[model samples]
Target: MLIVCHPVLYSAVVILRMVDRKLSEIAYSIRESFHDSGYTEIFPPAFLKSDKVDGFRFIYRNKIFVLEPDITLRLMNRHITENSKIYYISQQSDEYLNESLKAGSEIMGGDEDETNIEILRMAIKILDNLGIKNYNIDISLTGIFDSYVRKKDGQHLIRAVKSRNYPQIQDMEIDDKDKLLQIMDTRTRKSGIDKLDSIIERIDDPRIIIDLGTVRQPEYYNGLIFEIYGKQEFLGGGGNYIMKNLRGCGFSLDLQALSKLYHGSHERVEK
Candidate 1:
């Protein structure tokens, strides 16, 4: 029997295969880098039972289960030993049922400065290994914003700062408003800037940008935070956080986004 298929459907199938192949290559490169850096791979369960619906929830055998939204959170629940380096590639889904592929590494229990430097270096090395050169890292210290949050009308002021709403920030009644404004402008060499400067001096990478306005996941990230960006889109980001009373820092890459960038650049080079 001869099977007949539409040309469009065939073309779509071919494209899908190409995409999957490229994604696999990207994941392999990331995993190789992790292994070379002495990090062990970890596999966490896909479905978790929790009262809080942080991810897509479903009923399995009359028991409520939620799709794992955060691999880091799941790792934290485990008894991670001190100075353990672990990496993972996992499928994550959010409350809206949006799924994404993440490749991440976590360094558990090490000197804060050393751990931060090591993570940043590893992130940069992985990007370089992938031949991704045109990228910038936006670094920030959450403590800067946390200090302001303790002040009166702090939340509103912090919101203004994050959004760069200068007028709204000015209208807020916070002490040292000018200083806060300066920090927002990335002009102040105060408090948290020193930490950024120290890291910059050690890393000596011009791609690192001091961005004090970045205060993402305040409840989760306690210290330094950084995001990786390609030419037009965010690749991924991570930061220092306390989990189960343990200090840890790590970063994750959006493997799908990364594959697109890597494939596009390589295709252009070949052409």
Candidate 2:
């Protein structure tokens, strides 16, 4: 059977090819950055037999597979091979055929402070490689949540912080209200990191702001939390987290978003 193609369909095919070429270049550039930074790239198993993950389970060949949401949880498991530094690029299908392409790096099997610095530095280098300078890494922590989470209306407060909903935080009757707002204040991040560290001057610096208020709901984030932003849009981000008993740090880049931004198709970001 011969299929007819409209001029509009031909145009759409051309646009897709252009977009695919751009994406390939971006992926290669980012991967090279990871390699230059001493990170070994790995294609982690897409399906795992154990551990809780965000994906649904399905049986294949009489065996069940749990689709992986991310790699942080696998690092500390005794069964998983531990490495010095690593990164990966992969995607998971959503409810649609198109998948979100992701690329990120991690500092595993390393000192706590050293891991933190290396990951943050790498985050900056990634932004630089992408020509994204108008950005800030909003930093926060789990301890703040661990202590204040038990307070009245705790869940609401967390939502406010994660969404940056100031009115919700202001209206809450919790005792930590004022303190939470103060933490959300970006102006205090430098001083806050300093307060969290005695030798801030000695460390490699990145543009940072501290929002010690609410946090992203991830079981892995039992330590430092951060989100990278270019103005209001999130470029990419991650944090110091515990994968079981071992402490590690890593970040994931939103490859699709960067492509959209670079292509001046930012309006389609939601689509």
Clashes of each: 0, 0
lDDT of 2 by residue, 102-163 (tens): 88877765776667767887878876776666777766666776556677777776777788
**Error of model 2, residue 125, in angstroms:** 1.3
Scored by lDDT, model 1 comes in at 0.83
Top TM-score prediction, candidate number:
1
Candidate 1 per-residue lDDT over residues 68-135, each given as its tens digit: 76877678558789889999999999888899999999998889999999999999988887878889
lDDT score, residue 5, model 1? 93
Evaluate all candidate structures by whole-model CA lDDT and list the values in order: 0.83, 0.67
Where is model 2 more than 4 Å wrong at Cα? Answer: 1-5, 57-65, 74-83, 93-98, 192-206, 263-271
TM-score list, all predictions: 0.85, 0.80
Clashes by residue pair, model 1: none
Q: What is the C-alpha RMSD of each candidate to the true structure, in Å?
A: 3.1, 4.9
